[model samples]
Target: MRRKLAAGNWKMNGSLSAMAEVQALCEAHPEPKVDMLLCPPATLIWPMASMRGEHPLAVGAQDCHPEDKGAHTGDIAAPMLREAGATAVIVGHSERRADHGESSETVRAKAEAAHRAGLLAVVCVGETLEEREAGRALEVVGEQLAASLPPGSTGETVVVAYEPVWAIGTGKVAGTEEIGEMHGFLREALRKSHPEAADAIRLLYGGSVKGSNAAEIFAVPDVDGALVGGASLTAEQFSPIVTALEGA
Candidate 1:
């Protein structure tokens, strides 16, 4: 079976000492059955990567540039993140899309950069409320998935995250059926583009995923895991989601 993962994205929140919660989380539930990751802000990448947790917890970066070195001001490279001990880097998050106006092709180049640096690329895709209401949700998501993923992508090098734009950080979630459709569609989309990676690659759902609904949300077919937000702020908030993942 493909590995299930429960990754927490701290987004723009967290202090220098905030990462200690991950260590507490490990002790609270050591040896998690599913994989786990904490993608903090770029500034915390090195500190969290070097952290010694009671259980293994991979470190991640919120974003990176396609080039190893660039004239781009304030942009970090994927290799820099890898050298800092980060295992993965999130690409094309809705926040990045909205805040930075990143394009799908830009995200693909960033993913390629991560692969070149030997880091996993968590590429994100989603649709807005307007798109969803207009019934263009699937089309938008599928387009993003295709254009945002570069050629030669594989399961080991990249993971797909489905975060419905309308739900992320909004205390809302896509219904199970909708989640299933999007993820399942993405699975096939990747299969068509990279057949060898179809069964092995993991597809994660992100967007207001919390303790009360994590288990059921995770149980949805084609939903291999989640990219948790808000709740990831504390062990108290994030632990239950991990517990639900473990129990699942």
Candidate 2:
């Protein structure tokens, strides 16, 4: 069976003071039943990882450069993230895709770099509101999934996150039926190429996930967990979501 995961994307938020939340999270779930991960900003990765030493909580980075080193000003490389004590890194998040104009090919290369640095790649794929309205949500996500993941991806090296663009940070969330359908479709798509790793791969749903709706969302089929946004900033808000995933 695939292990359930509860991951938080702090996005561009948080500072050294925010590390207290990580402490609270670790204290609340000293021995959590589900895997827990937090992807903080580049500045907070090392501090958070250090504070989490020997704890069940794992730390990750929001993004990374494809190259291992050299000449990429203002860019952090995958290896650099690993060196900062990050065990995983998020790639192709909607903000990155929209704001930086990151294409699927670029995401794929970054994932490859994450793999080379021995870090798990949390590859994000989703559809915009227009695509959904046009009945092309599946088509858009399918294309992103196909092109954003690197070749030879396995369950251990990769995790897929589906975050509908319209829902992220807008206090909106895809309904259970919508989430389930897309997750199931992603499973089938992964099975086509990585048949051996498909079943083992955990699929996470993102976009405005919170403690209140977490249980219902987790109940959806093939939804192994979530990629939480704003709600993840504090233990009080995020712990309940983790509890929901544990019960799921």
Candidate 3:
């Protein structure tokens, strides 16, 4: 069975003072039923990982370089993230795609790099408002899923997150039917490409996910969990969502 995961993405946010939330979350869920992961900015990975000592919670990085080591300035490698106590890394987030112009091929390469470093790659794919409005949401997301994923990805090594561009950070959560349709489509797409690994792969939904709406989102079929934003910055906001997933 696929274990439900509640992941938090503190995108471009958090500082040393914010590490307290990690401790609070760990304290609140000493024996959590669902898998938990918190991906902070690269600067906080080590510190947050250090704070997680014996907790079941896992620490991850927001992004990683495709190459293990390179002369690329301001780029952190997958191995470096692993060395810094990260067991997973998020790749192909919308922000990276928009701000950095990362293509599916680049995302695929980064996922491979994460695997090479023994870190689970939480790859993301989504459709923009324009694509959805044009009735090409599925087409856009399908192509992304096919091209962004690397070969040999299994439930253990990879996780997929779908975050609609219009919904992310915009507080506009997709309706249950909309979410279910996309997730089901993603499952079918995965089945065709990686038949053996399809059913086992965990599919996560991301986009302004908060405690208030988390349970409803989790109720959708094939939605293994969520890659939460804003609300994940504090235990007060994030713990409830984690608890909801545990019940899901």
Candidate 4:
């Protein structure tokens, strides 16, 4: 069976003082049954990973450069993230796609880079409100999955997160049915290209995920866990969500 994961993305938020929550979170779930990950901004990866101590909490980075080494001014290479203590990195987040105009091909290259540097790539895909309302949600996400996943992707190297563009950070969430449909679609899509590892690959739902609705969301078939946003900022908020998944 695939192990469930609770991955937090700190986005552009958090500073040195925010490390307090990391301590509280690790202390709260010293021996959590499910996998726990926190992808803070690049600035905190080293500090957060160091502070994790012997806790099961894994630290990750928000993004990385597609190349191992380059003259790219503001870009970080995957190897650097690995050296900085991050074992995983997120790519193709909707925010990046919108704000930076990243394409699926770029995401795939980044995923390949993550693999080359021995980091798990948490690839994200989602449909905008217009696409969803037009009933093209599945089609859009499916295309993204096909193009964004790296050539050698497997369960060990990749995790897929489906976050509806309309819902992210908007205090909205896809209904359980909607989440279930997209996750199921993503799994089948993964099988097409990764037949051998499809079942092992975990599919996570993201979008305003919190304690109040985590249990119900976890109940959905094919939903291995979540890629939490704002709610993951604190132990008091995230702990309950983690507890809900452990019970699921």
What lDDT does each candidate get? Answer: 0.89, 0.95, 0.95, 0.94
The C-alpha RMSD in Å for every predicted model, in order, reads 1.1, 0.7, 0.6, 0.6
Candidate 4 collision pairs? none
**What is the lDDT for 179 in model 2?**
94
Q: Give the TM-score of candidate 2.
A: 0.99
Could you tell me which residue pairs clash in candidate 2?
none
Segments in model 2 whose C-alpha atoms lie over 4 Å from true places: none
Clashes of each: 0, 0, 0, 0
Residues 143-231 of candidate 3: C-alpha lDDT, one tens digit per residue: 99999999989999999999999999899999999999999999999999999999999999999888899999999999999999999
User: Candidate 4 residues 119-234, lDDT tens each?
Assistant: 99999999999999999999999999999998768889999999999999998989988998888888888888999999999999999999999999999999999999999999
Estimate the lDDT of model 1.
Answer: 0.89
For model 4, the superposed segments whose C-alpha errors exceed 4 Å read none
Q: Write the per-residue lDDT of candidate 2 for residues 1-248, one digit (tens) a residue.
A: 99999999998899999999999999999999999999999999889989887897989999999899999899999999999999999999999999999999999999999999999999999999999999999999999999998888998999999999999999989998899899999999999978888998889999999999999999999999999999999999999999999999
TM per model? 0.97, 0.99, 0.99, 0.99
